[model samples]
Target: MESDLRIAGTNSRPDIVAWAASEDGKVVPWVVIEIKSGASSSKPEFVLPQVAQYASTLGTADNYVVMGTKWFKADRSFRRLEPVSGPTPPPFGSHGEVDDPAVVEPLLTNWLASLTREMAPRELPVGLPTLEGFSVTNEAYWRAAMRAIADTTSRSGFAQHSSSPLIAALVARLIGNRLEGLVLDPFSGVGSFLWAVADRVRGAMERGESPPNVRLLGVELEERTAAIARAIGEIAGVPTDIVAGDAFRVELPMSSAIVTAPPVGMRLPQPYELLNGRVTTDMDLAAVDLSLRHLEEGGRAVILLPRSFVYRSSGDAYREYLANEFRVGALIGTPRGAVPGTSFAGVVLVIDKGDAPGETFVGQAADDDWQVQLGVEGALTKAAVDHLDGFSEIWS
Candidate 1:
C-alpha cells in the first residue's frame, strides 16, 4: 500500500494499493483506493475523472475513493478523456463495487499502511487477449471493463458506446422465439446482445425446455473487442462467431433474428444502399436497412437507436416503405443516459419482415431506470411484446 504514483505529472501516494498475481506470476497493483476527508473538495466522490487517470497511470482494474462513510469507484481504462465531457462524479455506494474501507480504515488509523486486506484477491484482468486465466464472462467484471473503456474514449454528447447487458436484454426479447437458424448481430460492440441471447436460451435450457436451435454471429469492426466477445461466448459455453470486420462489407446470411445496438450518429459520406434497393446517408437508417436486407422472410430485427431516428427527416422514405411492405412491431423509448457515451434518449425498434405493419406497439419509458421500460417484465416491453404476439389476429 501507500505506493507512489505519477498521476497528473505529480508524485502522489495512494492510501492503499492492492496487488494481484498474473498468470505468469508477475505481481501487479490490481486496485487503488484513496481516502479523503468528507469536508474536503477533493473527496473521492468528486474526483472520478482524476481517479480514472489514477487507474490508467497505475494500471489498476478498479479504483476506489473513500470519504467518511461514502465510497466512490472507477474502473480501469487505458484511454484518457478529453475536455467538454467534463467529469461526471460517481455516486456514493455504487451498486456492486468491489471495495470496503472498513478494513483499510482500521489499518489507516493504526498506521499499518503496508498491510494487505485478509480477503483473497482476484486475478488481474488486464483486458482483452492480454490477461491469461481471466474470464470476461463474469457480467460484473465485464460491465466494469466495458464502462471503463466507454467513459474514457467518448468525450462528446453524441458518442457510440457499448450497450449494457440490461439494454441488451431489452432488445433481445423482441427477437422472441426466432432462435432457429441464424441469429445475427450486425453491429455487435463487445457482443452484449449476443450474450443476452445466449443467456435467454440458457435460461430456457435450465427450465428443461428446448429453445430453437440457433447459430450466433456477430460482426464487429474492432478486432480486439471482437476477440473478447468471442472469448466471452466460448467461456459461457455458447459457440458465438464474432467476425473482425465491418458488417456492411462482409458477406451475410439470411438471419432469423438480428439483435444489435449499432454505433450512434455516424453518417455515410456517400449514399449507401444499406436498405432494400434504397440509399441513405444516415448510418442509423442504413444499419436497419442492412439488417432488413439479410433478415429472412419470417425473421425479426430488434435494434436500439437514437430516439431521433424515429422522426428524422432522412428516414421518411424508409419508414414509408416499411409501413407498406414490412411489420414495424414496436417502438419503445429509453430514457436519456440509458446508454453510456450517449446523452440522449434511445428507441428500441422492432421489425418483422414477413408480416405487414399492424397496430404497432408504441410505448415511452417512465424513468431513467430502463428496467421499468425494457426489463423482461418491463411494463412497456411486456405490452409491446403482447401486441406483437397477437397482432396477426388483426388480419384474421
Candidate 2:
C-alpha cells in the first residue's frame, strides 16, 4: 500500500494505491483509493465519478472512494454510474470506529502486492534522505527545502506563510540560546518556529556542545494542517506534539518560551474565557494574551502583529494592558508584503516577563533591503540584533 502516491506523469495523486499478488507472486494493481476528510466534500455521487476517472487511466475497474468513513464502489451495470456499499470501513477514527481486520487486512494485503508489481519495471528518481538524517547533517539544504514546501503550499488568505526563516531564527534566538522545558506555539501552522529551534539545538549538539533539552508543543485549529506539521516534525526527527483543537479552549502546559504568528483579522465566534474574567473578540491579540499566561516568569514571547495594532484606536485598551503586564522589548517593523497574501504590514513585538521598559525600540526596513536583512546571515547582523534587543532608546 502507498499513500499520497503520485501517478506517473500525472498531476493527480490518489490518497492510497493498493496492489494484489498474482499466482506466481507477481504484483498487480488491485484498487485505487481516494479518501476525503470529514470536513471536505466527499459525497458519494461526487467522489465515485472522480475515483472512477482516476481508475480508468490504470485500465482497471477496481476503484474505491471514501468520504469521511463511508466507502463506496462504483457500479456501471446501468447507463449511469451508481455507488454501492463495500466492506471497507468508514473514515478511519470517526467516533472512535476501529477497522475490522477481517475486512481490511485482506484488502490492504492485496493492494500492496499489486503496487509491488506495478513498480517492477520503473526506474524512479533517487529519493532524498529522510528529513531527520538530512537535516542534522545539512542545515542549509534542510532550510531551503522547508521554505520551498511552505511557499508551494501556502494559500493567500486562508493559510499563508507569514514567518520568514530569518525571522523564525531571530525569534528563537531571542527566546534563549538554551531553551529547556517546553516551547509552545499557539498558532503553529507548519511548525516553522519549532523546526528552526530544533535545527539550532541540533546544530549545537553536532558541534560537541551541550544544548538544553527542549520539547516543542503546538496547537492548530485545522486538523489537516496539524497533520502536516506533525509529518514535518517526524521527518525532521524533532519530538513535537501538535494538537488539533481550538487553542482558546485547549489546556496548555507552562512554557519556557513562546513564539507564534497568530492569524490576522480573524474574529472569535465567542468571547474567550481568560483568567480574571478577561474576554476579547480579537483573536490575534487574544492569542498573544493567552500565550503570556502560559509563559513562566522571565519567559520570552516573540509574536507578529499588524502594524495598526500600535496605533489603532480599537486596540488602545489592549495596548495599555500589554504595557502594564509585559515588558515591551522591541517592535521591529517588517517590510510591506512581507507576508505572502496580505498588504497589511506587520511588526515583530518582543515581550518578556520583566519590568516594563520606559520606551520600545522601533526600527524599519526597506522593501528591497528587507530580503537581505531577514535572511539567515542577515538576522545575526549587529543592526538586526540590536533592533531585536531593544538597544536603541527610541520610544514608541
TM-score of each: 0.62, 0.59
For residues 199-308, what per-residue lDDT tens digits would candidate 2 score against the true structure? 76777776777767788998888665576566556645456888888888889898988989888788899887544356678777677788888988867888877887
lDDT (Cα atoms) of all candidates against the true structure: 0.65, 0.62
Candidate 2 lowest-lDDT run of ten: 93-102
lDDT (Cα, tens digit) per residue for candidate 1, span 201-320: 766766677766767999988665575566556644456788889887899888989998878768777789744566777888888888998999988999998999889886878888
Model 2 residue 267 CA deviation (Å) reads 0.7
- Local error of candidate 1 at 377, Å? 1.3
Error of 2 at 255 (Å): 0.5
Segments of candidate 1 deviating more than 4 angstroms? 1-161, 274-277, 391-396
Worst 10 residues of 1 by lDDT: 108-117
Top-scoring candidate (lDDT): 1
